[model samples]
Target: MKKVLTACLLFVSSLTFAQQTVQRSAKLPNSDITETFSVLRSDKKIKQGEYTATAGNNTTLAQGTYLNGERAGIWSFYNISGKLIQTYNYTDNQLTFADSTDTKGLQYVMAGVKTDDDVTVPVKIGGSYSFRPTFLSKVLTQAINKDFGPVANATFIHTFSLNSKGEVTNHQVKVCINGQNKLYQVDDSELDHDLTRFAPAMVNNNPIPCKVITTNTVAMSNGNLPDYANSTYLGQ
Candidate 1:
Protein backbone atom coordinates (compact mmCIF):
# COMPACT_ATOMS: atom_id res chain seq x y z
CA MET A 1 0.00 0.00 0.00
CA LYS A 2 2.83 2.42 0.84
CA LYS A 3 4.60 1.70 -2.43
CA VAL A 4 1.39 2.28 -4.39
CA LEU A 5 0.84 5.68 -2.73
CA THR A 6 4.44 6.74 -3.36
CA ALA A 7 4.20 5.73 -6.97
CA CYS A 8 1.04 7.75 -7.41
CA LEU A 9 2.63 10.85 -5.83
CA LEU A 10 5.66 10.61 -8.07
CA PHE A 11 3.47 10.17 -11.11
CA VAL A 12 1.54 13.30 -10.25
CA SER A 13 4.74 15.21 -9.70
CA SER A 14 6.11 14.13 -13.07
CA LEU A 15 2.93 15.21 -14.81
CA THR A 16 3.11 18.60 -13.13
CA PHE A 17 6.75 19.19 -13.98
CA ALA A 18 7.05 17.53 -17.37
CA GLN A 19 3.80 18.51 -18.97
CA GLN A 20 2.78 19.50 -22.50
CA THR A 21 4.54 22.83 -22.68
CA VAL A 22 7.25 23.99 -25.05
CA GLN A 23 9.69 26.85 -24.80
CA ARG A 24 9.23 29.47 -27.51
CA SER A 25 10.62 32.83 -28.55
CA ALA A 26 9.09 35.68 -30.49
CA LYS A 27 10.21 39.12 -31.68
CA LEU A 28 7.80 41.90 -30.86
CA PRO A 29 6.23 43.57 -33.89
CA ASN A 30 7.94 46.81 -34.93
CA SER A 31 10.05 46.61 -31.75
CA ASP A 32 13.59 45.48 -31.18
CA ILE A 33 12.52 43.33 -28.23
CA THR A 34 12.38 39.55 -28.17
CA GLU A 35 10.38 37.54 -25.68
CA THR A 36 11.36 34.05 -24.53
CA PHE A 37 8.67 32.09 -22.79
CA SER A 38 6.80 28.82 -22.55
CA VAL A 39 3.51 28.03 -24.17
CA LEU A 40 1.11 25.14 -24.30
CA ARG A 41 2.22 22.58 -26.83
CA SER A 42 -1.31 22.00 -28.00
CA ASP A 43 -2.25 25.65 -28.41
CA LYS A 44 0.84 27.89 -28.83
CA LYS A 45 -1.08 30.80 -27.37
CA ILE A 46 -1.43 29.91 -23.72
CA LYS A 47 1.69 31.04 -21.89
CA GLN A 48 3.03 28.95 -19.06
CA GLY A 49 6.11 28.69 -16.89
CA GLU A 50 8.81 31.41 -16.81
CA TYR A 51 8.60 34.35 -19.22
CA THR A 52 11.15 37.01 -20.12
CA ALA A 53 11.39 39.92 -22.53
CA THR A 54 14.72 41.24 -23.71
CA ALA A 55 15.72 44.26 -25.76
CA GLY A 56 17.94 44.33 -28.84
CA ASN A 57 20.90 45.41 -26.71
CA ASN A 58 20.56 42.19 -24.67
CA THR A 59 18.95 44.02 -21.75
CA THR A 60 16.27 42.28 -19.76
CA LEU A 61 13.15 44.36 -20.12
CA ALA A 62 10.75 42.34 -18.01
CA GLN A 63 10.77 38.90 -16.45
CA GLY A 64 8.12 36.98 -14.55
CA THR A 65 6.39 33.64 -14.22
CA TYR A 66 3.08 32.86 -15.78
CA LEU A 67 0.88 30.11 -14.43
CA ASN A 68 -1.23 28.66 -17.23
CA GLY A 69 -2.31 32.02 -18.67
CA GLU A 70 -2.23 34.68 -16.00
CA ARG A 71 0.77 36.39 -14.47
CA ALA A 72 1.69 34.70 -11.21
CA GLY A 73 4.31 35.07 -8.49
CA ILE A 74 6.62 38.08 -8.13
CA TRP A 75 7.46 40.00 -11.31
CA SER A 76 10.51 42.26 -11.31
CA PHE A 77 10.46 45.33 -13.53
CA TYR A 78 13.75 46.92 -14.52
CA ASN A 79 14.59 50.43 -15.65
CA ILE A 80 16.24 51.33 -18.97
CA SER A 81 19.61 51.13 -17.26
CA GLY A 82 18.85 47.57 -16.20
CA LYS A 83 18.34 48.71 -12.63
CA LEU A 84 15.86 46.97 -10.42
CA ILE A 85 12.92 49.32 -10.26
CA GLN A 86 10.05 47.39 -8.78
CA THR A 87 8.94 43.90 -7.73
CA TYR A 88 5.26 43.10 -7.63
CA ASN A 89 3.89 39.88 -6.20
CA TYR A 90 0.78 38.81 -7.98
CA THR A 91 0.12 35.88 -5.71
CA ASP A 92 0.14 38.11 -2.64
CA ASN A 93 -1.05 41.19 -4.52
CA GLN A 94 1.58 43.53 -3.11
CA LEU A 95 4.50 45.58 -4.32
CA THR A 96 7.80 44.66 -2.73
CA PHE A 97 9.86 47.68 -3.77
CA ALA A 98 9.73 50.67 -6.08
CA ASP A 99 12.48 53.14 -7.06
CA SER A 100 10.91 56.50 -7.67
CA THR A 101 14.21 58.11 -8.68
CA ASP A 102 14.83 55.88 -11.67
CA THR A 103 12.85 57.39 -14.50
CA LYS A 104 14.28 55.18 -17.21
CA GLY A 105 13.94 51.41 -16.99
CA LEU A 106 15.25 49.00 -19.60
CA GLN A 107 11.52 48.55 -20.14
CA TYR A 108 8.33 50.38 -19.30
CA VAL A 109 4.87 49.11 -18.48
CA MET A 110 2.61 51.77 -19.94
CA ALA A 111 -1.06 51.30 -19.16
CA GLY A 112 -4.39 53.11 -19.43
CA VAL A 113 -5.55 55.29 -22.32
CA LYS A 114 -2.97 58.01 -21.80
CA THR A 115 0.12 58.17 -23.99
CA ASP A 116 1.87 60.94 -22.07
CA ASP A 117 3.60 58.99 -19.29
CA ASP A 118 4.50 62.08 -17.33
CA VAL A 119 0.92 63.04 -16.56
CA THR A 120 -0.46 59.57 -15.91
CA VAL A 121 -2.19 59.55 -12.54
CA PRO A 122 -1.95 56.99 -9.79
CA VAL A 123 -4.47 54.20 -9.49
CA LYS A 124 -5.72 52.20 -6.53
CA ILE A 125 -4.73 48.56 -6.33
CA GLY A 126 -8.27 47.51 -6.91
CA GLY A 127 -9.61 48.82 -10.21
CA SER A 128 -12.96 49.41 -8.53
CA TYR A 129 -14.20 49.73 -4.96
CA SER A 130 -15.53 46.18 -5.02
CA PHE A 131 -12.08 44.86 -5.94
CA ARG A 132 -10.05 47.20 -3.72
CA PRO A 133 -7.92 45.57 -1.05
CA THR A 134 -8.00 48.49 1.36
CA PHE A 135 -10.27 49.38 4.24
CA LEU A 136 -11.74 52.19 2.15
CA SER A 137 -15.30 51.19 2.91
CA LYS A 138 -14.66 51.24 6.62
CA VAL A 139 -12.93 54.59 6.42
CA LEU A 140 -15.62 56.11 4.23
CA THR A 141 -18.36 54.74 6.45
CA GLN A 142 -16.71 56.35 9.43
CA ALA A 143 -16.43 59.66 7.64
CA ILE A 144 -20.06 59.62 6.62
CA ASN A 145 -21.13 58.69 10.10
CA LYS A 146 -19.21 61.54 11.60
CA ASP A 147 -19.84 64.27 9.06
CA PHE A 148 -22.94 63.30 7.12
CA GLY A 149 -24.70 61.75 10.12
CA PRO A 150 -26.18 58.49 8.71
CA VAL A 151 -27.35 56.72 5.60
CA ALA A 152 -30.59 57.98 4.16
CA ASN A 153 -32.21 58.33 0.76
CA ALA A 154 -30.16 61.41 0.05
CA THR A 155 -26.91 61.52 -1.93
CA PHE A 156 -23.81 63.68 -1.71
CA ILE A 157 -20.73 64.32 -3.83
CA HIS A 158 -17.92 62.65 -1.95
CA THR A 159 -14.34 62.84 -3.16
CA PHE A 160 -12.52 60.01 -1.47
CA SER A 161 -8.93 60.71 -2.33
CA LEU A 162 -5.48 59.62 -1.24
CA ASN A 163 -2.08 61.25 -1.33
CA SER A 164 0.98 60.20 -3.33
CA LYS A 165 2.08 58.05 -0.40
CA GLY A 166 -1.15 56.04 -0.67
CA GLU A 167 -2.48 57.26 2.64
CA VAL A 168 -5.96 58.41 3.46
CA THR A 169 -5.89 62.18 3.34
CA ASN A 170 -8.37 64.96 3.91
CA HIS A 171 -11.24 63.59 1.82
CA GLN A 172 -14.08 65.97 1.25
CA VAL A 173 -17.84 65.87 0.65
CA LYS A 174 -20.29 68.35 -0.81
CA VAL A 175 -23.92 68.49 0.16
CA CYS A 176 -26.73 70.99 0.34
CA ILE A 177 -28.27 71.44 3.76
CA ASN A 178 -31.11 73.89 4.39
CA GLY A 179 -30.64 75.45 0.94
CA GLN A 180 -26.94 76.12 1.66
CA ASN A 181 -23.97 74.41 0.06
CA LYS A 182 -21.70 72.83 2.64
CA LEU A 183 -18.33 71.15 2.28
CA TYR A 184 -16.93 69.04 5.07
CA GLN A 185 -13.37 67.87 5.35
CA VAL A 186 -13.07 64.32 6.56
CA ASP A 187 -9.61 63.75 7.94
CA ASP A 188 -8.76 60.11 8.28
CA SER A 189 -5.46 58.29 8.70
CA GLU A 190 -4.50 55.07 6.91
CA LEU A 191 -2.95 53.40 9.88
CA ASP A 192 -4.26 49.99 8.97
CA HIS A 193 -4.38 49.82 5.16
CA ASP A 194 -1.87 51.73 3.07
CA LEU A 195 -2.14 52.02 -0.75
CA THR A 196 1.57 51.85 -1.48
CA ARG A 197 1.64 48.09 -1.00
CA PHE A 198 -0.49 47.70 -4.10
CA ALA A 199 2.27 48.80 -6.48
CA PRO A 200 0.79 52.18 -7.32
CA ALA A 201 1.21 54.12 -10.58
CA MET A 202 4.72 54.34 -11.92
CA VAL A 203 6.07 56.50 -14.74
CA ASN A 204 8.69 54.86 -16.92
CA ASN A 205 8.92 52.16 -14.28
CA ASN A 206 9.70 54.83 -11.72
CA PRO A 207 7.55 54.91 -8.65
CA ILE A 208 6.25 58.37 -7.86
CA PRO A 209 3.36 59.97 -6.08
CA CYS A 210 0.23 60.38 -8.16
CA LYS A 211 -3.30 61.36 -7.30
CA VAL A 212 -6.44 59.50 -8.48
CA ILE A 213 -9.23 61.96 -9.12
CA THR A 214 -12.64 60.34 -8.92
CA THR A 215 -16.08 61.79 -8.58
CA ASN A 216 -17.97 59.54 -6.21
CA THR A 217 -21.68 60.01 -5.71
CA VAL A 218 -22.38 58.60 -2.30
CA ALA A 219 -26.08 57.90 -2.36
CA MET A 220 -28.17 57.09 0.66
CA SER A 221 -25.19 57.90 2.80
CA ASN A 222 -24.98 61.52 3.86
CA GLY A 223 -28.06 62.52 5.78
CA ASN A 224 -29.51 65.79 7.07
CA LEU A 225 -26.96 68.34 8.32
CA PRO A 226 -26.76 71.87 9.60
CA ASP A 227 -26.36 74.87 7.29
CA TYR A 228 -22.97 76.45 6.66
CA ALA A 229 -21.64 79.62 4.99
CA ASN A 230 -20.98 79.70 1.23
CA SER A 231 -17.28 80.10 1.90
CA THR A 232 -17.34 76.76 3.70
CA TYR A 233 -17.81 74.99 0.37
CA LEU A 234 -14.25 73.76 0.55
CA GLY A 235 -13.35 77.48 0.14
CA GLN A 236 -14.50 76.98 -3.46
Candidate 2:
Protein backbone atom coordinates (compact mmCIF):
# COMPACT_ATOMS: atom_id res chain seq x y z
CA MET A 1 0.00 0.00 0.00
CA LYS A 2 1.19 3.55 -0.73
CA LYS A 3 1.32 5.95 2.25
CA VAL A 4 1.92 9.67 2.83
CA LEU A 5 2.42 11.20 6.28
CA THR A 6 0.73 14.44 7.23
CA ALA A 7 3.61 15.12 9.61
CA CYS A 8 2.69 18.57 10.95
CA LEU A 9 -0.99 17.85 10.38
CA LEU A 10 -1.06 15.02 12.88
CA PHE A 11 0.99 17.00 15.39
CA VAL A 12 -1.54 19.83 15.26
CA SER A 13 -4.73 17.81 14.92
CA SER A 14 -4.22 14.92 17.34
CA LEU A 15 -0.84 15.13 19.06
CA THR A 16 0.75 12.45 16.81
CA PHE A 17 -2.24 10.89 15.08
CA ALA A 18 -0.68 10.84 11.65
CA GLN A 19 -3.05 10.23 8.77
CA GLN A 20 -2.42 7.52 6.22
CA THR A 21 -3.03 8.26 2.54
CA VAL A 22 -5.11 5.75 0.72
CA GLN A 23 -7.04 5.60 -2.56
CA ARG A 24 -10.68 6.26 -1.74
CA SER A 25 -13.72 6.69 -4.01
CA ALA A 26 -17.40 7.18 -3.22
CA LYS A 27 -20.58 8.88 -4.36
CA LEU A 28 -21.61 12.11 -2.68
CA PRO A 29 -24.75 11.69 -0.60
CA ASN A 30 -28.04 12.58 -2.30
CA SER A 31 -26.18 13.42 -5.50
CA ASP A 32 -25.12 11.71 -8.69
CA ILE A 33 -21.52 12.83 -8.10
CA THR A 34 -18.81 10.28 -7.50
CA GLU A 35 -15.57 11.68 -6.04
CA THR A 36 -12.11 10.86 -4.78
CA PHE A 37 -10.62 12.45 -1.68
CA SER A 38 -8.13 11.80 1.05
CA VAL A 39 -9.26 10.34 4.38
CA LEU A 40 -7.75 9.77 7.79
CA ARG A 41 -5.84 6.50 7.96
CA SER A 42 -7.12 5.67 11.40
CA ASP A 43 -10.63 7.16 11.41
CA LYS A 44 -11.43 7.03 7.69
CA LYS A 45 -12.85 10.57 7.69
CA ILE A 46 -12.16 12.98 4.89
CA LYS A 47 -9.03 15.00 5.56
CA GLN A 48 -7.52 18.07 3.98
CA GLY A 49 -6.55 17.19 0.42
CA GLU A 50 -7.38 17.37 -3.27
CA TYR A 51 -10.94 16.65 -4.30
CA THR A 52 -12.32 15.72 -7.71
CA ALA A 53 -15.85 14.92 -8.83
CA THR A 54 -16.86 13.29 -12.08
CA ALA A 55 -19.91 12.39 -14.10
CA GLY A 56 -20.96 8.75 -14.42
CA ASN A 57 -18.74 8.36 -17.48
CA ASN A 58 -15.76 9.53 -15.38
CA THR A 59 -15.80 13.00 -16.92
CA THR A 60 -14.52 15.62 -14.47
CA LEU A 61 -17.22 17.95 -13.20
CA ALA A 62 -15.35 19.91 -10.51
CA GLN A 63 -11.76 20.13 -9.29
CA GLY A 64 -10.33 21.88 -6.24
CA THR A 65 -8.75 21.41 -2.85
CA TYR A 66 -10.30 20.81 0.58
CA LEU A 67 -9.04 22.32 3.79
CA ASN A 68 -10.26 20.95 7.12
CA GLY A 69 -13.22 19.43 5.28
CA GLU A 70 -14.12 22.73 3.61
CA ARG A 71 -13.47 23.60 -0.03
CA ALA A 72 -10.29 25.66 -0.26
CA GLY A 73 -8.03 27.14 -2.95
CA ILE A 74 -9.06 27.49 -6.59
CA TRP A 75 -12.03 25.49 -7.80
CA SER A 76 -12.81 24.99 -11.46
CA PHE A 77 -16.33 24.06 -12.59
CA TYR A 78 -17.01 22.58 -15.99
CA ASN A 79 -19.98 21.70 -18.13
CA ILE A 80 -20.76 18.10 -19.12
CA SER A 81 -18.56 18.03 -22.24
CA GLY A 82 -15.57 19.31 -20.25
CA LYS A 83 -15.48 22.95 -21.32
CA LEU A 84 -14.46 25.23 -18.46
CA ILE A 85 -17.40 27.40 -17.44
CA GLN A 86 -16.26 29.14 -14.26
CA THR A 87 -13.69 29.20 -11.53
CA TYR A 88 -13.72 30.31 -7.91
CA ASN A 89 -10.83 31.12 -5.63
CA TYR A 90 -11.75 29.90 -2.17
CA THR A 91 -8.55 30.90 -0.41
CA ASP A 92 -8.94 34.57 -1.38
CA ASN A 93 -12.73 34.57 -0.92
CA GLN A 94 -13.22 35.63 -4.53
CA LEU A 95 -15.35 34.40 -7.37
CA THR A 96 -12.29 34.80 -9.60
CA PHE A 97 -13.00 34.59 -13.33
CA ALA A 98 -15.74 33.29 -15.53
CA ASP A 99 -14.54 31.74 -18.78
CA SER A 100 -14.48 35.07 -20.62
CA THR A 101 -11.71 34.59 -23.15
CA ASP A 102 -11.52 32.43 -26.24
CA THR A 103 -10.36 28.98 -25.08
CA LYS A 104 -6.98 28.51 -26.78
CA GLY A 105 -4.46 25.73 -26.60
CA LEU A 106 -2.40 23.58 -28.92
CA GLN A 107 -4.68 20.56 -28.73
CA TYR A 108 -7.95 22.54 -28.57
CA VAL A 109 -9.14 25.85 -29.97
CA MET A 110 -12.25 28.10 -30.09
CA ALA A 111 -12.57 31.65 -31.35
CA GLY A 112 -14.32 35.05 -31.07
CA VAL A 113 -15.95 35.16 -27.61
CA LYS A 114 -16.67 38.43 -25.86
CA THR A 115 -18.13 38.93 -22.38
CA ASP A 116 -20.89 41.49 -22.68
CA ASP A 117 -23.57 42.33 -20.13
CA ASP A 118 -26.15 39.53 -20.03
CA VAL A 119 -24.88 37.97 -23.24
CA THR A 120 -25.39 34.25 -22.81
CA VAL A 121 -24.59 31.22 -24.90
CA PRO A 122 -26.98 28.81 -26.55
CA VAL A 123 -28.11 25.61 -24.93
CA LYS A 124 -29.09 22.25 -26.32
CA ILE A 125 -32.72 21.32 -25.67
CA GLY A 126 -31.96 18.42 -23.32
CA GLY A 127 -28.63 19.58 -21.86
CA SER A 128 -25.66 17.21 -21.70
CA TYR A 129 -27.63 14.20 -20.56
CA SER A 130 -29.22 14.10 -23.97
CA PHE A 131 -26.34 15.66 -25.87
CA ARG A 132 -23.38 13.51 -24.90
CA PRO A 133 -24.64 9.96 -25.35
CA THR A 134 -26.86 10.99 -28.23
CA PHE A 135 -24.72 13.24 -30.37
CA LEU A 136 -21.11 13.35 -29.12
CA SER A 137 -20.49 9.63 -28.66
CA LYS A 138 -22.29 8.63 -31.79
CA VAL A 139 -21.55 11.59 -34.02
CA LEU A 140 -17.92 12.25 -33.14
CA THR A 141 -16.75 8.75 -32.40
CA GLN A 142 -18.56 6.74 -35.01
CA ALA A 143 -18.50 9.48 -37.61
CA ILE A 144 -14.83 10.37 -37.12
CA ASN A 145 -13.69 6.79 -37.03
CA LYS A 146 -15.70 5.90 -40.09
CA ASP A 147 -14.73 9.01 -42.03
CA PHE A 148 -11.10 9.39 -40.91
CA GLY A 149 -10.36 5.68 -40.81
CA PRO A 150 -10.32 3.57 -37.63
CA VAL A 151 -8.46 5.72 -35.14
CA ALA A 152 -7.92 3.66 -32.01
CA ASN A 153 -7.29 6.69 -29.78
CA ALA A 154 -7.13 10.48 -30.18
CA THR A 155 -8.39 13.92 -29.10
CA PHE A 156 -10.91 16.07 -30.96
CA ILE A 157 -11.81 19.75 -30.83
CA HIS A 158 -15.03 20.81 -32.51
CA THR A 159 -16.13 24.43 -32.84
CA PHE A 160 -19.17 25.82 -34.56
CA SER A 161 -21.02 29.13 -34.69
CA LEU A 162 -24.71 29.56 -33.89
CA ASN A 163 -26.95 32.44 -34.93
CA SER A 164 -29.89 34.01 -33.10
CA LYS A 165 -32.15 31.46 -34.76
CA GLY A 166 -30.05 28.64 -33.25
CA GLU A 167 -28.79 27.64 -36.66
CA VAL A 168 -25.27 26.31 -36.19
CA THR A 169 -22.77 26.97 -39.00
CA ASN A 170 -19.07 27.00 -39.85
CA HIS A 171 -18.39 23.67 -38.17
CA GLN A 172 -14.69 22.89 -37.84
CA VAL A 173 -12.73 20.13 -36.14
CA LYS A 174 -9.10 19.68 -35.11
CA VAL A 175 -7.77 16.20 -34.65
CA CYS A 176 -4.78 15.84 -32.29
CA ILE A 177 -2.52 12.87 -32.65
CA ASN A 178 0.88 12.44 -31.03
CA GLY A 179 0.88 16.20 -30.35
CA GLN A 180 0.33 16.99 -34.05
CA ASN A 181 -2.91 18.76 -34.91
CA LYS A 182 -4.79 18.58 -38.20
CA LEU A 183 -7.64 21.00 -38.72
CA TYR A 184 -10.69 19.93 -40.69
CA GLN A 185 -13.60 22.06 -41.86
CA VAL A 186 -16.17 19.32 -42.01
CA ASP A 187 -19.15 19.17 -44.31
CA ASP A 188 -22.43 17.66 -43.11
CA SER A 189 -21.95 14.74 -45.46
CA GLU A 190 -18.40 14.00 -44.25
CA LEU A 191 -19.47 13.87 -40.59
CA ASP A 192 -22.30 11.46 -41.38
CA HIS A 193 -24.52 12.89 -38.55
CA ASP A 194 -26.54 15.98 -37.96
CA LEU A 195 -24.89 18.64 -35.74
CA THR A 196 -27.64 18.29 -33.12
CA ARG A 197 -29.90 21.15 -32.01
CA PHE A 198 -29.55 24.22 -29.81
CA ALA A 199 -32.08 26.52 -28.15
CA PRO A 200 -30.31 29.83 -28.87
CA ALA A 201 -28.17 32.28 -26.93
CA MET A 202 -29.93 35.08 -25.09
CA VAL A 203 -29.20 38.64 -23.99
CA ASN A 204 -31.67 40.57 -21.83
CA ASN A 205 -34.77 38.74 -23.11
CA ASN A 206 -33.51 38.79 -26.69
CA PRO A 207 -31.62 36.11 -28.55
CA ILE A 208 -27.98 36.54 -29.51
CA PRO A 209 -25.41 34.62 -31.51
CA CYS A 210 -22.50 32.67 -30.03
CA LYS A 211 -19.92 30.02 -30.69
CA VAL A 212 -20.02 26.47 -29.36
CA ILE A 213 -16.72 24.75 -28.62
CA THR A 214 -15.98 21.32 -27.21
CA THR A 215 -13.00 19.01 -26.64
CA ASN A 216 -13.08 15.26 -26.38
CA THR A 217 -10.33 12.82 -25.45
CA VAL A 218 -10.81 9.37 -26.91
CA ALA A 219 -8.72 6.48 -25.66
CA MET A 220 -9.60 2.85 -26.23
CA SER A 221 -9.54 1.38 -22.76
CA ASN A 222 -11.61 -0.55 -20.25
CA GLY A 223 -12.75 2.83 -18.81
CA ASN A 224 -10.25 5.60 -17.95
CA LEU A 225 -10.90 8.06 -20.76
CA PRO A 226 -14.33 7.83 -22.31
CA ASP A 227 -14.85 9.19 -25.81
CA TYR A 228 -14.62 13.02 -25.50
CA ALA A 229 -14.35 12.70 -21.69
CA ASN A 230 -11.28 14.75 -21.01
CA SER A 231 -8.98 15.95 -18.21
CA THR A 232 -11.70 17.01 -19.13
CA TYR A 233 -12.48 19.50 -21.95
CA LEU A 234 -12.44 23.21 -22.68
CA GLY A 235 -16.10 23.50 -23.68
CA GLN A 236 -17.94 26.79 -24.12
Top candidate by TM-score: 1
The reply for model 2, stretches above 4 Å from the true place, is: 1-116, 133-152, 188-195, 221-236
Give the alpha-carbon lDDT of every model: 0.51, 0.55
Q: What is the TM-score of each predicted model, taking all chains together? A: 0.41, 0.38
Top candidate (lDDT) = 2
- Superposed on all Cα atoms, the candidates' RMSDs to the truth, in angstroms, are 17.5, 13.3
Q: Candidate 1 at residue 70, lDDT? A: 70
| Model 2 Cα lDDT, one tens digit per residue, 1-236 | 12335665555675433345554788543234577887666556655577777786677877777666566778776765687766666576454555543233312222344455465555543234223432243354455555555444667777767777666666677877656677766544322121244556677667767777777665655332234443233343
The whole-model C-alpha lDDT of candidate 2 against the native structure comes to 0.55
Over the stretch 148-228, how does candidate 1's per-residue lDDT look in tens digits? 464333234445444445544545656543344556564433322422233445566665544333332223423532221
